[model samples]
Target: MTASAPQVPPRVRVSEASLNVLRSHTDQLTTAVNLHLEGTLPWYRQLTTDERASLRLIAQRGIMGLVNWLDNPQTRSLPLVNELLGSAPTDLMRSISLQRALQLIRTIVEAVEHRLPGLVPVGDQQGMLEAVLRYSREVAFAIADVYARAAESRGAWDSRLEALLVDAVLRGEASEQITSRASAVGWGSTCGVVVVVGPAPEQADAAFMSHLRRQCVRFAADAVVGVQGDRLVLLLGGVTDLDTGLERIMPSFGPGHVVYSRIEGSIDQAHRCAQAAYSGHAAAPAWTLAPNPVPADDLLPERALAGDDTARQMLRDAIFAPLAEAGNGLLETVTAYISAGHSLEGTARELYVHPNTVRYRLRRVTDITGWDPTEPRDAYVLQTALAVGRL
Candidate 1:
């Protein structure tokens, strides 16, 4: 069975003389609480003059609220106390932690309890003391509620800002506004940034997002997460080993190929990384046997086949241009090797050269382009680069 809510007690009935006495001593009580804070709390003395004045005003409000509650015990104290504390400056509320706030409440309670004998008739003093204790308890809960709401609001705002920053990076909008937004979300300037793209988990709720963030921190990296339709995009910074870090957080993604981009030197170049990663994710299905968590550059042939201009240009620059620049018939021999069904003797026959000469040129091609024409996969990439270069 569900538990019932606690019932609030009826308001205490104090005489008019006692209520007037409490009302007349509001300023005196406020000053007494401030003096007690200065003497008992070392941190209270460190506040600036304006902060101290703000605290004085908050304390006065609290005392005035307490007096009004004592006059009419039927009045609800929670909203009244919340309204009183809400008048405090936001910075002051943050500067005074929950523990410090509780201490401040204790100080006020003690100050009131000490003055009860002079403020009330002996017969009514006990009731007044009990009322003060009850009101202080309500004020404590109100303070906690206020801080909790503030924290939740801040978390929500940061999540939206983070999503916007990731979206900006994906769209290649590296403006000053992106930089400022990045800074606002605590994106560090550390180098070795990368973008990882994959299918988002089916249950991409707040708890899952929080777990994903914890995983990033576990690997000593800073990250921003964005969910676009079914895809999850993660921008990670300060990763020393991309492979190991991705491996650790692989479970955070859904069931699909997880593709990451090359390590960028800085965050400003993250857009380039994001472009490659996104292209790779789109083209990942073309290669059924490709490894999960594959590098975007490793999928250049597929990306090029998918009509990615950036991938086409990358292939031309990294493979074709270098081979063309390297002399000794390197480009011509590799072209003939691929065209001749990757047969060294056929390439030698086509070029009217010895097989050994064809072999030497193919080795040079491997050394220059880092793709061995002898390997079937590398052979396909070389063929694609050759075709893209001619275009």
Candidate 2:
């Protein structure tokens, strides 16, 4: 006959007597853990009384959970461990980071291990120790899982709030609610802000958007991104150089025109910036030779032709009004220059002045309106401004 396999004893488990002993000492163990944390962790000592009490309650629950798990070794303990920490208030939970939570768990386990010799019989002591080790491991994992889920939920909520704020700015709504939302998203910048608009990427999912946001941070800027249909809108803050910042983040946009609005003084005025960017993005297709990351102001003529009232008013105010206000026949020279195919001699002939006078007036036009009648793009913008001003 084949030799029979040697019998193996069942795995050791904590006895009922030891379970009762551990249960009675749960409060003692909790106190030990809290005292250890207070003595060892500098951050713990800084917590308010209520916050410390909250942590004390968590430690008590953790010890109690360990006892219950020891009583029924096969029972699921992760859920119990999860519930123990899940009851913490949002602020309290944030105060105790994962590292600190794990440190507390280790302290609790050590407290029990230190008292095991007196609490249980020698045979049961090993089983109790093993149980504590197993339970502490589960508790560590539970802490990590809970914190991860909290981060994910917070991220989703923040994304929603960010999108809502972008929508409000686009709608030109600057109320207390908008301010509250901006604060919720940590947009506390009183510095200049701007809005950028482009086509949404073909795959504008959470991952892509997250990467885009990271890119913004890498460039030392803050951004709130919103995808409205096929359009991608971004509200950028704390940028010192708009051109350099835009160039840094240009790759985040899709394969279409990327336009940024004029910088507003602060987030409160970002709605005006958003209006310009929205209008520019809508009219971007009209300018074939426009640069990839063109300024919203650069597209004023196209936006005016597309019936953007704000763009029309902007052109009229920023371009036409200044030239019209400045005397010395600057407006007449600009009109005559454009009408004469940007010919200085032709304009001089029309104005019955020397070409040098026409050239001097053209220089004045550039200085006054920030646009030149000779450059093709500036000519178009000036011509549009003149038309809108006439209208």
Candidate 3:
């Protein structure tokens, strides 16, 4: 017999007091959050484990301060924040009440979808998500109450912690141990890293960082910035190309986000690449790129330089060592001969000397170097040797 699919438990309705507490706390927290910056949100004190997890998701949305206003906190936070501030959040609160059930459904749906995007919907999530959402609302309300009371104490500590976070990333002093510990906490696969150099025109030492976050929903990527040192060094993970990383970031700001861009290399190579990128920009030099790793099979600069180094050097040095010791005249004469197409008269005319004088010098060079100018190949060899020796 075919067993029927498990039913999703219905949402448990949230109490009025719980809802009021949430609203009040939201308003207070909204006031508490300093809106001057982007990435530095205050450390979420208090709240149960479930609440913290929910807040983290909200924070991932880029504006943890307004979780309820934006249905999809990941996408709609900024615009919704703008809308709420322009008028008021009361209407927003009321509007949210209408979609509470829908929001609960979305939460469960997202959880399931991430593991299996195309799986048939199961109703089990409905009840569980409802419970989680209610718990989160209550947590938010509790946080709000704390904010109202401990605004000064909480804000200061949170700010300090946030600054520390930014500082640690920038310093590149992050030890393998710390990095390993963070890995223990389980960060997802970041194929590569991009270091964003900020162009803060207002101050001498201002910088901006853009940490690229991938939306688990659409798998869309964008940068979230934090302050680093005197500049902002944004660490963007999950992008392969630097250009693609910048493109992902630029449009997310929705226009008026004009600035220069240069990408640092992979996550492993970020420190060096970041410094190089910054130096290049500051010095008006070419942007430094961290070349991707290659196999032994790939040709490189040293490969291109390969050839009869000993022979080439011996011949080249034998030709010019005498001239260099005495003066640049022989060197000059040889260059003139090549430029004149190894023609006696042409070499003389170019050097503003008699053709006989040019011929005598060529003869002397042939005797000393054993490289006869008459041999077209010998002349070519001399020319190439001169060029390579200088380099």
Rank the models by lDDT, top first.
1, 2, 3
- lDDT of every predicted structure (CA atoms): 0.83, 0.81, 0.43
The candidate scoring highest on TM-score is 2
lDDT of 1: 0.83
Clashing pairs in 2: none
lDDT of 2 by residue, 171-223 (tens): 87856777787888999677778789998988987778777888776554678
Q: Report clash pairs, candidate 1.
A: none
The clash number for model 2 is 0
Worst 10 residues of 2 by lDDT: 83-92
lDDT string for model 1 (8-120, tens) is 87667778888788888888888888888898889889988888888888788877787777766555545775566566736557678878878888887897788777868
Better of 1 and 2 by TM-score: 2
The digit string of per-residue lDDT tens for model 3 on 259-335 reads 23223333434454444334433332211221221111111112213443433445446655755665536667788
**What TM-scores do the predictions have?**
0.85, 0.90, 0.30
- Looking at model 1, residue 217 earns an lDDT score of 69
Q: How many angstroms is residue 257 displaced in model 1 relative to the true structure, after the best TM-score fit?
A: 2.1
| Cα RMSD, each candidate | 3.3, 4.1, 18.5
Q: Is candidate 2 or candidate 3 better by TM-score?
A: 2
Candidate 2 accuracy as lDDT: 0.81
